[model samples]
Target: MDSRFVGIADLVETPSVAVVVDVMRACTVAAWAFAQGAERIVLAESLDEALALKARHPDWAALKDGPLAPGFDMVNSPGLLRSIDLAGRTVVQKTTAGTVGALAVKGASLVLCAGFVVAEATARLLRTHECDSVTFVVTGEDGQADEDLACAQYIARRATGAGTDASEFLGRAAASRAATELATGVRQGVHPDDVALCLELDRFPFAMVATSEGPQMVLRPCAATSPTDAASI
Candidate 1:
């Protein structure tokens, strides 16, 4: 690993792990999907691909397509996902930027899904390693704004033993400007409340992992050895 930077789609090779982020919607949706009891999420970079996966497993799958225009199954929204029941079922998701962003780093040596919700767990994951370098790839945002950059900086600070103050970092002028932009029109498609939900740290302990079965993303709820015992997070 050589250098670490914000932004997701564009990244170079490294011997260390790469933290993939889709903060605006994808990661948030994944978090909610798990919270609602989804067995797994198959993240496809393309809508057609995700649909195809559903076609293969129609008996037990549903598709959530990102907002492109109007003729899609579902727009990437955590609220919409929350309203549905997915217990013991799987979700096939396709997002314009997030899913594609994850696929972009398919060749990396180590790739892990991340967002503000699992920031502490992400820090813990980083603590378990001692590589020469680590990169947190913040997808969708081009690094000109605070959302992804703030998250990237947060991860980098964790990796380097530096302090992380999220609100302060996001309170900068540039970030405020971006917030204005997001409010006016460019990012109106995103839900502010859901964004806040995704930023909450450590509501779950499971790290969303991509596997052959699908994107097995969910909180592996603590298990109690016996009926009288309490479960731990």
Candidate 2:
């Protein structure tokens, strides 16, 4: 299958598979939630929609970040997801980039969220399917370079059988604005551990794919065993 690294504006025309990336944090948090056995994750486009979903399903956990309303169960932090026991609980997430990008794609039959944590496994899952082309959606770009672009570049390379080894990509991500802010205590409500977790390559042996149920975009994991797999750092 062919692979192309594109921004969210190109979301309209995707092939059989589209992997949305927000490696700075959103997809990282979602990956950890799945790793901790979340039943399924819902992506909400707005705070009101997320609150409405929460009102309907009171048992489900609601998470939000990036200037959303304050009723969410937790901030959308990967560090927070690390400590939660989310087994069988539905996760409703609202974020500026990741959730929005994941939900905006209308053409692809399958949409998977990508981060360094699940990079290789996501690529492996893509290979299992018979696709003519795949698009890696980089959500973090805002007229400038960002970590999500770095991640999408890496995943696209690996998905199209062009490369292996994540060191170079990881370095670029670590030096990106998001990682640097967290490392320097410039980004509030975020910890260094969260950025650290996001940079660890191939940490999860699964890919998080977004599927629609009615009007909601719910995410589920597709797992595979890896020789280099380690659950935690």
Candidate 3:
């Protein structure tokens, strides 16, 4: 099998599978939302698209570029979701990096979103799908973010059956520039708890896969194999 890593600035060639990583919150939040019983997630490319989605599904949660809107149930922060109940509801998400990266890799046979939460599941899925070539896409805001790169490396290593160390990977990601900024930006509405949550590796046992339906990118959970089964891959 062949695997390659591509940052936001680099153009990605469609491989057998495209694994998009956004460790600093966006993808992490999506995993948490699904684990919390969200029906499905609709990822939009822009704030206007998110708003239009909200207009169509008034009961669903809408998240744009900034803080939680008046009518929206939650923002992009995983910490914010801790206070809300998303059982059987849908979420419309638009972010500067994660969702955008997910939408960009349309040429791949499969597009999966990866974060610390779904790293193991992602690796198992690639092995199960028998993907000979995989592209790891890091959704960095300015060329490359440490957290995203770290997550990409971790997933690649795990998928390739290399020596895997979850603690070391999480430590590197937690100390990244993006993590530090979010942890210290409480006044800017960035919560330390949110950063903490994003740093937790393999918190969920499912991978988020994006499938195109008409003009929308729909995200759903893929049940992962057991840790023992994943390690044997």
Candidate 1 on 149-220: residue-level lDDT in tens?
A: 666667667655567676654444224443455445565445555545555655666555443333432222
Off by over 4 Å in 1: 1-3, 6-9, 60-73, 161-163, 170-192, 211-233
lDDT of each: 0.57, 0.78, 0.79
lDDT of 2 by residue, 1-233 (tens): 77777777765555567889898788999988887778788999888999999999999888887433466787777876788888888989988888888887745697889899999888777767655688778887651446887788787777766666778788889899888877787766675588889998988878877878897788777663331232331
TM-score of each: 0.75, 0.89, 0.90
Q: Give the range of the ten consecutive residues with the poorest summed lDDT in model 2.
A: 224-233
Pitting candidate 1 against candidate 3, the one with the higher lDDT is 3
Clashes of 1: 0
Q: List the residue pairs that clash in candidate 2.
A: none
Q: Better model by TM-score, 1 or 3? A: 3
- Comparing 1 with 2 on lDDT, the higher-scoring candidate is 2
Model 3 poorest 10 in a row by lDDT: 224-233
Tens-digit lDDT track of model 3 for 1-233: 68778865686355668899998778988888887778788998888788888989898888754576665556778777766777788999888899988888866678889898788888888777777888888888654787888888888888877778878778888888888777777324455588888987788878888888788898888765431221211
